[model samples]
Target: MGESEQKVAKEPTEETAEVTGATVATEVSALPAEAPAVLPKTPPKGSKSYELIFLVDAALPKEELDALIAKVQGIIEQREGIVENVRVSDVRRLAYEIKKRTHGVYVVVNFFLLPSQIAELERLLRLDERVLRHMVICTRSS
Candidate 1:
């Protein structure tokens, strides 16, 4: 091998057991390609308020949609937001199909978030492909 051509080595750790920051490759030649893992999350803890409504794939079961709703609710709670209510309005035909589906499930999540925390919540939603449509509007005092 030329002086310019050299092999590089990497150190391993318990998390992924690989080089750089990537998980080490486990030999399973027969297995199909692995799906990407979701990134680590840091949640907030405390009191806050906001309202978020989103549309999910109606084809999914009540449990499945509920599971995802729970996940989002957890994130909100972690970030100091309090979950007030979660309403799941299952599969309704859209005036027209969205993302090629003629129907979708609706979810309304009422919560309280710190004024500064809205951006974080929005970012999480943007990253999740499950949401077909979403809106977060600040509430006025009653």
Candidate 2:
């Protein structure tokens, strides 16, 4: 093709660059200034809140049941963790049998502990035969 017929590529002009920069600046400035109001409160440093739910065999006697619960709380406290709350619900029929048991006791414990110690806590809970099933969930935003 001849030089005059060939298409030429043009670089962005000074005005084009200025307009792009101004558009970005305006978009950033449009964000809310009070962002903290919409954000969740951060927990204390080096610790996070977690909720532990476990199902225990309902056939256990009252004394043993109480002891097991206390033992779990003790484990958390022994590791320098704080127990916020413990809710023990009466034995209820399970949606499906767990370890051949139709009814089970539900225990919910909320506490704060270091993230690194979660594996150890879960290991200890798994060793107890009375606890049929258990789950740990983080309740606070990282």
Candidate 3:
């Protein structure tokens, strides 16, 4: 391009001006040197309520399913978790196939557990062949 075209291209437009203004404001209003750094707030040190939902292979026998549920309960209890409820739904057809299976047995577990132990529990579930899919969500009011 010519020198004039290059100069025009380099000129700051309204968008660039606004961006520069914001950047300047952000830099100037940053925390003062003497101010303490901010930290994230954490919940009190106690068990947190959570609901765990998982899908198991539908083809498993009733005895096998019971054993799987017992194994899950054991994991939670081993991690200082308290199981409040354990519900199992009948084997039903799935919307889409998983692991070449057309149906799954749905199980929902409500419990109080430490947040730190959730990862380990999920890891165990993931490694179990009986489990097809699983989800864990907080049930705390806050």
Better of 2 and 3 by TM-score: 2
Provide the overall lDDT of each model, using Cα atoms, as 2-decimal numbers: 0.69, 0.78, 0.78
Order the candidates by lDDT, highest first. 2, 3, 1
Candidate 1 lDDT score relative to the true structure: 0.69
Per-candidate TM-scores read 0.62, 0.67, 0.67
Q: Which whole-number lDDT from 0 to 100 does residue 20 have in model 3?
A: 13
Q: Between candidates 1 and 3, which one is better according to TM-score?
A: 3
C-alpha RMSD by candidate, in order = 13.4, 21.8, 19.3
Candidate 2, residues 1-142: lDDT per residue as tens digits?
8865544444433331221122221212233444455654344568889999999998987678778878988998888788877877777999998899999988888988888888999999999998999999999943
Backbone clashes for every candidate come to 10, 0, 0
Clashes of 3: 0
lDDT for model 3: 0.78
27-142 in candidate 3: lDDT tens per residue? 22434456698874443467798999999888898778878888988998888778877888877999999999999889999888888899999999999989999999999922
| Model 2 weakest lDDT span, ten residues long | 19-28
Best by TM-score: 2
Question: In model 2, how large is the Cα lDDT of residue 133?
Answer: 96
